[model samples]
Target: MTRFAQAVAESTRSVPVPRRPDTGRTRVTWRQRLGRDRVLVLVALPGIASLVLFHYLPLLGNVIAFKDYVPYIGILESEWVGLANFAVIVNGDPLFLNALGNTVIITLLQVLVVFPAPIALALLLNSLMSERIKRVVQSVLYLPHFLSWVIVVAIFQYMLGDAGLLNNFMRDYDLGTVSIIGNPEAFKALVTGQVLWKDAGWATILFLAALARIDNTLYEASAVDGAGRARQLWHVTLPGLRSLIILLLILRLGDSLSVGFEQIVLQRETYGADAAEVLDTYVYYNGILAGEWGSSAAVGMVKGLVGLLLVLGANKLAHRFGERGIYQS
Candidate 1:
């Protein structure tokens, strides 16, 4: 044997081996922990099963976008139409173009104006001195978020509809009454306003959370350095929330095509299709009402694909600016 092997053998012969302690207790503890985890998974099984059955399973229906889908014929019997549906949406459908334009306009308007309002509101609330006043303001703000869209729309109607509150008050005072709801020219503005009223407070929750997580020491340091409130907000608060702001912005970009689906559908008749027909509304009208399933599915598929690309692009852009996007690097 080699010198190292001889040394190891001599060491082994001189040393007494110690007996291993019983591991049955440790094994039983591990078994108990595993049993608890299994029970937790069992409790979550219904939700997991529902998502698989309803959400993921229904994804198979998207195949209809590529076929001449007929309800009575079923998916297997339907003739393959290849790219015909997509071609019609791109080259032949005037209404599709109109709806696309409206969706883009609304998305842009909301992203620029409405999206920032919650962040601003949250910052203002975070700066408040009195806890009671802050709590009251938050409660009032969050109340609107829980209101149904139908109720919100009805409230808008009561305030802005012809011979409604504002118009009647204007007439009684001999002031000019403005058409706000049914006016095609103001439809974008009205939708943005509705969004602001309904969800601005709710959206503030995320920003407020982000603001709360910021280091108070940074603010104190800024104050010692002779920075004013505005300066601290701009330099310290905003910088701290930058990653969260970018993440939220990327999510909004992914959902750009989905702007104002139910809202547009509800008001389409009032403003006419030309003014209120967003992609989702267009899909509903054409697919469900007109029985053009393939065409509508094609539109939806396109929107989903484009949205996916936008999110990917935005995430990449965020990383280029030295920030982690929704996903980590």
Candidate 2:
């Protein structure tokens, strides 16, 4: 070997060689991952069991929709009746239709009017400079969320019932008493108000969290650019919250058919089924109370399918608008 060949050999030896990437390495098995994170897996077992036991297991009971279900005979022993029960819904039982109408009306009111309330409230609360005052206000607002539907209904009755607080005050002053509690025309509005008052503050928690996540630098930049408060909100705040808003809206659509069962059931006696009945109450009355189990199950199954479709459609629309929505595509 010449000097030049020796120099080249030395130079090659001095240079570091890159190892090949481990493209052929086996991926970690789920079992291995679970073993490594056994603590987390153990912690999650209760929730997993609950979901399987409560949610997934009960889905099998939907078979009752196709059966002439009898409590004594049990689900397995019931005679299958294909789509006969669904004909009752299609043929338009007056009671079921009335309940469905009430449900749609209430859902629309909640979606259109009540839905934006928490966002507005959160924005207001977020803008407040006094943390102490905001915390106090938030506590007062959140208190109603902890109250049971029964308690909330009773509170409304006490305040709005004939000869209740408002009526009593009006009577004392010789003013005409207002009758709102059992008014059919006002039922939708009443429920909307009740939902807003009871849960709106609790709903604000998510919006507040989303608001908190918004980069303060964006606001600072907007301020430096001479944007007014309104401009900043419109430009920076709303954009930052767009994804969360879409996600919650999609979830709301998924649950559009489920206007509070307990709330409506509690008020049904006062307002009658005409005004207060919804799909859930209808199921309770027809299935549990009247023993028309098959028909009720059929109606419920349809409601669930509709809710599923609504969620899918809403998510699709969200994707069209460049949002990831509740789940990624």
Q: Estimate each model's TM-score.
A: 0.88, 0.91
lDDT of 1 by residue, 86-168 (tens): 97576957999999999999999999898999999998899899999999999999998998888888899899998789999
lDDT per residue as tens, model 2, 1-329: 99999999999999856554677555667898989999998999999999999999999999999999998989999999998889779999999999999999999999998899999999999989999999999999999999999899899988999969999999999998988988887888888999999999999999999999999999999999999999999999999999999999999999999999988888888788888899999999989999999999999999999999999999999999999988888
Clashing pairs in 2: none
- The numbered model that scores best in lDDT is 2
The residue pairs in collision within model 1 are none
Off by over 4 Å in 1: 1-36
Error of 2 at 110 (Å): 0.8
What TM-score does structure 1 among the candidates reach? 0.88
Computed on alpha carbons, the lDDT of every model, listed in order, comes to: 0.90, 0.93
